[model samples]
Target: MSEPQYKRILLKISGEALAGEASRGLDFGVIGEVCEVIKECTQMGVQVGIVVGGGNFWRGVKDGAGRMERTRADHMGMMATTLNCLALADVLEQMGVEVRVQTAIEMRAIAEPYIRSRAIRHLEKGRVVIFGCGTGNPFFSTDTAAVLRAAEIDADIILLAKNIDGVYSADPNKDPNAVKYDFISYDDVLAQHLQVMDFTATSLSMDNKIPVLLFALKDPKNILRAVMGEQIGTIVKEEK
Candidate 1:
């Protein structure tokens, strides 16, 4: 098979991906599996940058305790991402892949603050950098952070490793016959109000002309396949 078209890619993984069938918290086995795939991609000469979400541990809007403010909940969510970042970094390191965790929020002792130049340098040295914290602020999702980081790092494409295999006209789980799009334009996504990512993230990617490939994370090999340009999922890009 021919290699993937991308030389550099940003992979956005939801915190939920780190969880096994349990539906909450970190699962080392799952993380280790993902790390192996990442190691393979790195070995294949593909530069990889990752942005991880904190939904497994926290979601600001979903908190029902009433005592927690939105910003406070979001802050906790950011910290949760740091924990996931550290875990991923450790696992990837054990896999013999150079990895770094950069946070949007200042957690000096645990990670380096998000610096575009430093991230770029790490990528140049063939190190995988995982970005944690959601834009270092509330009112933003990690999806937006992924797009921002991709643009900052000058990534060729954004790989959205989702729970589902690809973008669909409707929620496939709800509607069995929902059509899966093989390829789509960013505009089409926006126009159709598809939920591949949040509108903010989708708009940013469109504005920056970054293509996003959505694929399932259930198959660890999908990561390698994505980097190898296997066309395993929907590709969202600008229209020709």
Candidate 2:
């Protein structure tokens, strides 16, 4: 019931997370849990904008490895994101949360085209805005799109909901000795070549001075805990 540390946040969710244990397609149960947490954030008067990934359906680089042109493959990946946005929007709406979906690519039949001012207006009006398609360009990951949207909206912070608990010195799954960081500087992340995010996304966040809080999405309440300013994850920002 306390005031959240941030007034507005950009939440980046992995599509594979949405797929739950099946790891292949939409899992409404997991989506429902995530959406329930999102609803709670709205009830707390927090404005939310989301960028959901499309790895569950298609991974441009991995799936398009052989013969598909990179551009076409990425476009397919973008469409996959639209599927996720629509799925999230549907669930949120069913929960009585006003939702709007904006896509980087224009699809008049389904969603509004990405307009910076309009997207901000939607947030201000207490509507959840879901951004789909990765920057409307090929070769750019959804991570970059999330940061780009966060910067455009002037969000206080980005809540990155992933499978891992936080950033590790190395892949914790692969390396037992990998150390977890409660907080880290953007420069260190870059210098050490850590995979907190893709290089472009991390550099963009650093330049924009937008901090990213990375946490496991398994316990969705961690999203609320993060907004309440609890130290539950690895925070990446410029070191003062």
Candidate 3:
């Protein structure tokens, strides 16, 4: 087997990825499959750090109660992310992989609080670190957290596991003729205002020169393929 392309990588998995078919909540089958892929990547010597989203359980903007402030709603969302992270860490541990859940917000009873140096040390020790709570602040999405963690850890790439296979000119689900690029420049993505990721995350990755690999998470093995540098999905980076 060939050496993996990335020595260290940060994987960004949306909460929706954990929801297999249901409209809400997690599907353990999907989580188990994903864990299997992560185990394979770890066995190949790829240092992996994951950041999970919370859309499956809650979305701050979707609540109509009007009782909670926006910041409070967002904090609830962050807690939801921690739940997903804990579940994922449990599954990975069952698969015999050493895993750690580090939350930005302190939840000592459940997991370790986020400490940049400590998280880095965990990765260096070959343990998969899962980051939750979206920078420990409201209004920032998990996508931004992925980029922040990637920069903090000096990661080679950001593996964006999404529902779609790659970034398209338009929403492929809505447009039949949407064009998908095998590779794209960050400037092009920004110019097109593509929804591959939020502006903050995109700009940070671009500035740091960390390529973002956008691929579908449905195919669990794609995670391993991406770390191996297989041409399986769209890759966004600086134009050379």
**Top model number, lDDT:** 2
* Arranged by lDDT, best first: 2, 3, 1
At residue 117, candidate 2 shows an lDDT of 96
Give TM per candidate: 0.96, 0.99, 0.97
Q: Give the worst 10-residue stretch by lDDT in candidate 1.
A: 58-67
Which portions of model 3 show Cα errors greater than 4 Å? 64-67
Task: Evaluate all candidate structures by whole-model CA lDDT and list the values in order.
Answer: 0.90, 0.95, 0.92
Compare the candidates by TM-score and give the number of the best one.
2
- Sorted on TM-score, highest at the top, how do the candidates line up? 2, 3, 1
Q: What lDDT score goes with residue 10 in model 2?
A: 98
lDDT (tens digit, per residue) of candidate 3 on 1-240: 999999999999999989988947999999999999999999988999999999999987566148789888989999899989999999999999999899999989999999989998999899999999989988788899999999998999999998889999999899999999999999999999999899989998999999999999989999999988899889999996
Model 2 / residue 145 / CA error / Å: 0.2
Would you list the clashing residue pairs of candidate 3?
none
lDDT of 1 by residue, 86-139 (tens): 999999999899988899988889899889999999998999999999799888
lDDT at 220 for candidate 1?
A: 82
Residue 230, model 3: lDDT of: 93
